[model samples]
Target: MPSPRRTARQADLLERLVALLVAEGFASFTLDDLAERLRCSKTTLYQLAGTKQDLVREAVKHYFRGAADAVEKEIAETVDPASRVQVYLTTVAEQLSSLSRAFLDDMAQFPPAREVYEANTRLAADRVRNLIAEGVAAGAFREVHAAFVGEVAAATMRQIQLGEVGARIGLTDSEAYEQLASLIVHAVSS
Candidate 1:
């Protein structure tokens, strides 16, 4: 196990990295930029997280970890699978809406960041899959492929985050979430 001090340092570095990613977007920063912005040396960052891709991965993971925590909390608190899924989707929508446009604009410029983003997406999909599987076992949801429903739900969440179809349909984030939740419930409930 890592020492407590080392763990704390890693946490601090991750926090700083996340703030930088959120503020300037991943494309706006190089090793030198991060070194200057965080007042640390490139060597230190290298020691902390080998490559830029690694840094991006860690930062993206940190962001999604927080999202997952929220989803977990929602699951623990909600008795019904449908309500739990709605809370999870709505929470994600709210988070995406709160993200800085600069963050989104910058994210567009980085392929690695996109990859990291997609990985987090799969993580979210797995969470939804687990939820669906549990619901099915409890007879709250009809017999269906949990993985397929999870993938669709995850893709729908991404669509909302990207504001592609949701904006075209004149749906606010909450409205889009409700619509998605309704569809998910209809598809899964017996």
Candidate 2:
């Protein structure tokens, strides 16, 4: 079911809620806990969604939507086509910084929220491909296989999301992403 239209107050509350969920996660938070942390009543919380799971799903979607918007805005304002790819990847890294392990775990437990994350990653890969094409057209990047590059980036991102990087290297997901962005930018530099 669709959520009710959020008033300005509710929209503001959703931002706060996303921040909280990013840091702590909703899986462990009861409705009362959410009300306390979000500084609203249980009734107000229910207004956001029909149930706690529903609330969490909406919150995850909201977070991804906001992140996607910000990433697109950053890419749009960028002047260099080669740098667009860098900005795209690094913007995602910056967004990943706010995500805590608990939050990731919560999403893993919730398939719908996980699907939202996966969809964003797929879109990210597509954006990477587009940036590569732009760079090639502008003579900023070498004539290389953009599809192969995109697939590699997408796979690397998948491993990162699965915590394989952290599991093997003892680096946090955010740190891994930061390094990945740096490496990608350096590689793409003319």
User: For model 1, which pairs clash?
Assistant: none
- Candidate with maximal TM-score: 2
Poorly placed runs, candidate 2 (over 4 Å): 1-4, 186-190
Residue range 10-124, candidate 2, lDDT tens digits:
9999899999999997688999999998889999988888898888989998999889889889988999887888788878888888899999878877887888888887888
Taking the candidates one at a time, how many backbone clashes does each contain? Answer: 0, 0
TM-score of each: 0.72, 0.90
**True-structure Cα RMSD, model 1:** 4.0
lDDT of 1 at 128: 75
- Candidate 2 — worst ten consecutive residues by lDDT sum? 181-190
| Worst window of 10 by summed lDDT in candidate 1 | 1-10
Highest lDDT: give the candidate number.
Answer: 2
| 34 Cα displacement, candidate 1 (Å) | 1.9
